[model samples]
Target chain A: MRRPGPLALTCCDPLAAVTNATARIILICSGKGGVGKTTLTANLGIALAQLGQRTVVLDADFGLRNLDLLLGLENRIIYTAQELLAGSCRLEQALVKHKQQPNLALMPAGNPRMLEWLTPEDMRTVANLVAERADYVLIDCPAGVEQGFKNAAAACHEAIVITTPEMSAVRDADRVIGLLNSQGIQPIQLVLNRVRPRMVANQEMMSVADVTDLLALPLLGLVVEDEQVIVSTNRGEPLTLNGNGSPAARAYHNVARRLRGEQVPLHDPTRERRGLRARLLNKLGMAGN
Target chain B: MALFEFLQRLLGRQKPSGTLAKERLQLVLAHDRSDLNPELLEQMRREILEVVQKYVEIDLEEGDVSLETEDRVTALVANLPIKRARPAALTAPSD
Candidate 1:
């Protein structure tokens, strides 16, 4: 006993707290609504799952939980997060399994009235559970700078702001990034969603480079306004599962791979449609349709 | 026939998809951020016009100010000219 005196304290010491650990929590937020935050979150979760990461999406929009409907898991919700918070249910009891994807699951938000009492500490506690249980946690945030926004943004380690090329979306995104920075979250990534190519070809819209230049954040993903998106969302399924050969699907997959620290190519597939006409037309001063 | 021609002009198919999306998205996002709705923007514009008229001889309705967003920043931008005040007369004008 006297010889083993020093080993007593070292071997049985408790590990560091999880909140202090470097867990990866990615939050998808947007200042404006109807810019496809739910759709993006669903596809991204599926894409991450496809990359072999056990991903769990937490729909932080308590009152309006469209992530489940978008993912076609509305009917699978057994126990909401409020039940777990109230001690009436356990953590695993709240999870809704994905239809066919075994690795993917969702922890849907609580009742509309129940979420009214959920504090920031509660969200962090939920994140702690997700960090312990899954490889990655993607939180879908509510739009605008309100109570819901604050609640969803509470436990995030990093953020991915979704925006369109329009000046208004970019401007709101700038304000949201400023708010995130003030909250000690810096270097947020930007996902330029609903980018239309024909407009850029005709000099009618902002380009990806233009949007990024304005936002000046890391480009996590650039998704086109594909017809498949509307179709998949209508069918209450994710676009990532809609035939991997599609451009939007490939973009989502590439986004997931990039998130996994892979050196995925960031080719602007729409670039070919630009300037080729000019090159064929004897090198005009500017390219236009 | 005139109404049909005006409708054709208003809903012209020649507009590029990017242009239309950008235009619609700009209007929506401006309202989305700053919590300033379309009605509020109109009211603000009217109030601003009234306030500016008291200070400057703005052609009551000529000058325009609007809330615009650029790259995630919202700003109240105005197109009014910065006019200087007229020099005061040395003495009162004769009747």
Candidate 2:
């Protein structure tokens, strides 16, 4: 039998390029569920892809996986994390590449039973393997302080905590922040999702400043509460890709821009809403002055 | 609209919901970060009162034992004014 060439051996090695790879691993976590962690991950992945980044959103929530569903690629998932780890498929074969966005991909969770066997070390290996081919790997972490959270945070160098303006959400976020800080995760940022600016102005809902100050972390971005998010999500389309000129879409796109080291200003939907009203009134020649 | 705005402004002195939430969170999170739940704090207060009562007479109602944070450092500040010193026998140190 002829021996395989050195090139063939090296080509099949997934960890070969990991030594010199420089991928920014981000773990998107929340202490409370329904805070839009997976929604942010899917939208941010699409936004980063729009910025030409080779991004991979890893669904680290093993027992319950929804990233593929959010990305509208659940049916495209031929091989999962279990198959990849079982030596049945290559890493490239397991990654579900986005149809429209060539740069974005998803590494979905395996069978729920596999959650028991997956360790932090295994996650590190998978993350490192993908880091070789991708520029950014966003891990969608499960809620609460548990094994899934640990496994997700293990491979990530940076983290983003998502919370709403509610006290319970912020309290959970504070606990999650303490947990992430204990784990030595650096440069953790906050995303205030589902903000109602009018309510904030009327002193009903928490403001962005209030949340950031309470959480005591730098603000990454703020997503306004919009019906379009629900509609787009139900349609299995990321709001960033919808091109509907929604405030949440622009905010998510700005988040990706900020991640790319850009100095994009945070989008204020309330201000835009007022500005649009003024423009429409001016177009109709209604001069109150 | 202006009348409603005026009425809101007049009654705005009451604590807003967001501010109330913030205040509650500040207190609860300070305790949470220190790993001291209400139950634990209450238990600790009772134990501290028992220890202090053997040394000196004090009113538990007037005393205070709570958590406070300064520059991100948490401390369980306690204040228990002594009503009267214990007998010399109890105050005396055992060799």
Candidate 3:
């Protein structure tokens, strides 16, 4: 539930000062499928909420919506974006607040049938309504540059393009960046996901430099490949929810902090790979080795 | 086998597959960004040759046009072999 307060009065808290301004509407997208777009969205949503900023994650991928499932709010959803837009329910009625994180809310977009009738204007209308109450509105965009993508991008002022280091993913991301540019979206950023450090060190997989040099976008963060991500996803809990100290979880937290105008340094893969052995030795009190 | 592999590495006789992947991605992205396929590039070469031949004689078979990408910027590079300049009378207007 949303609490009412003065819209213009500035607060002593810096986080509140940011929330006083209009919500930042950002779209998370990737032109290719199964490249961790949804995963990034769910994790980032939780990370932002943990930072004490009121956040709303809208699942704009109507054809194959899963943000709710990833957030473990599927069973709690009684009304969706469809009902809100149809005037059967209010925005508060459609929004499902997280059980663990009350600061975060999830708005599941209408089902696949709504794909036939929903337009870009309708998306904007819903986004506008959601923005009135949130400090940040993250739209989980669908894959590919189709109508769904357009509807998702239509309401966003900024974009975060997520991609793996593979050739196909990078090529598709480049295309999606071109589309976002044409739409006049500003300050687009990139996230490199599922990076295997050892493979990169052995020159078997694409290095961070290789992908960044070609994409030509400021990298927001790097998420190392971790098996715990699969385990967390199957349990319908995002990596950022629990303080597991997983590489991907830390990366998500760093990304959220950076988004709030903090200066967190990016992760280096080679150093992280070497640090594992050193950390193990330190834990065993064998630092001299 | 390990010694032989070490020797090959020391002598720089082996190429890493990452280098190959980077090279291939550069070539393909150049084409993809410029929206120019091999057939289109050939057409462009022929048109460029026709325009250049109006002022100078060029070898039609030896002319080539291709895309090159560096620092994320793509350029259309052409190499046209010149046989000789056209005669003044042919190049100049009749008036």
Candidate 4:
């Protein structure tokens, strides 16, 4: 129950440390639906692990949970958080390891029939284990500011809001931000997701500057709408893993590095897309040279 | 100033969708957060108008007060029109 340093915040800081552990918990939330919160969570968990931190992606969406489906670990989860909470399994017994990444793990949500309710103590217990076990914990929160949302958020040290470059998402994010502020949680950052770079260049979408001005929040990451995201989601895999060289994959990795406290350059959305010949010409070392 | 002109010169500029959408979205969230319906606001306006009308000729439309809902508030703002006081009593005092 201790507060963290302004920018020097970590998951298990003395301020929030129950027993002097060093794990950091991050809750990824959105105020409204269909704003890419789940996708952001999957990629973020993968990104943090890729950045060399021991990370766990906790699916707190319960009842209608889908993180396992997104991570392609649905067929692999024999037990879930609900099972662990209900004493049917131990915490480590339920974790589904990533197929290729050894450092990352996925704690999937239970099936609908399990019907195990999560008490406040259960949330605290799970959050404590996150602090004890991993370097970072990324919990994928459900949409809406409801019980499920509160359940997921109560376990985190800080929050990252995922909003689309649209009004509804930003508005919901604004509400979530206001709530976080009231709860005395500081260092809340914003992530603008699914941006169309071409539209920004053409003035059809909101520029990053415009969104920052209106939202008046700390900017974390800006992800473009890459076709690779669709292909990866369709194939039930994280685009950050095993996806071929694509802009979205690169962007996810860059965000991952930034989350680990690196200085990754922000994309200039207003730049027009170059033609293939122009891209080739630039790659041939004449554009900057 | 140079950047301002460059942005202005960018042709066919539409209203920033994110800003506008955020505006409309925040407007609704204030009410949603508090579970207050629009009809409740109307009822309060009418009741407030009735209470004031009993004292003086309170303007209804031009003397409107409003309630604005944002992410953190349901603020009541009154844009009241003051009635002129018959030209300052026409002679200061009838001394």
Q: Is candidate 3 or candidate 4 better by TM-score?
A: 3
Per-candidate alpha-carbon RMSD to the true structure? 8.6, 7.3, 7.7, 9.6
Q: List the residue pairs that clash in candidate 2.
A: none
DockQ for each candidate? 0.18, 0.27, 0.30, 0.14
Give Cα-based local distance difference scores for all models: 0.73, 0.81, 0.82, 0.69
lDDT (Cα, tens digit) per residue for candidate 4, span A1-289: 4222211232434543334367778888888977777888788777777778888888877767878877888888898776665656655677788887777888887665543466445565666665556888888887888777777777778888888777667667877877777666667788888888655543346667766655667678888888878878888788888756777777778778877788988875546674443354345443221
By DockQ: ranked, best first: 3, 2, 1, 4
Model 2 CA deviation exceeding 4 Å by range:
A1-20, A268-289, B1-9, B12-14, B43-63, B69-73, B77-95
Per-residue lDDT of B1-95 in model 4, one digit per residue for the tens?
Answer: 14453344333243434335545654565565556578997788788876555444645669766556532556777765656434534454445
First chain of candidate 1, TM-score: 0.87
Q: Considering summed lDDT, which 10 consecutive residues are worst modelled in model 1 chain A? A: A1-10
The best candidate in terms of lDDT: 3
Reference-based lDDT, residue A194, model 3: 91
Residue A165 Cα positional deviation in candidate 2, in Å, after optimal superposition: 0.6
Order by TM-score, highest first: 3, 2, 4, 1
Clash pairs (backbone) in predicted model 4: A2-A15, A11-A24, A167-B21, A167-B22
lDDT of 2 by residue, A145-208 (tens): 7888888888899999999999999989988888889889998988999998666654456777
List candidate 4 segments past 4 Å from native. Answer: A1-20, A113-116, A201-203, A271-289, B1-23, B26-95
Per-residue lDDT of candidate 1, residues A1-289 (tens digit):
1212112322344542233244578889988888878888899899888777878899898977899998999988888777666656555678787877767889899888866587777777677665655788999998888888888788788898999877667767867887897798855888888877755654457777766755668898888878988888889889787555777888888888888888877867457665432243224333333
Interface RMSD per candidate (angstroms): 6.1, 7.8, 7.8, 8.8
Tens digits of per-residue lDDT for model 3, A1-289: 2221222222332433343247999999989999998899899999999999889999999999999989999999999988877767666778899999998999897879999998888888777667867999999999999999999999898999999988899889988987898899988999999988766654546788888888888999899898998999999999999979998999999999999999998868755564443354346443322
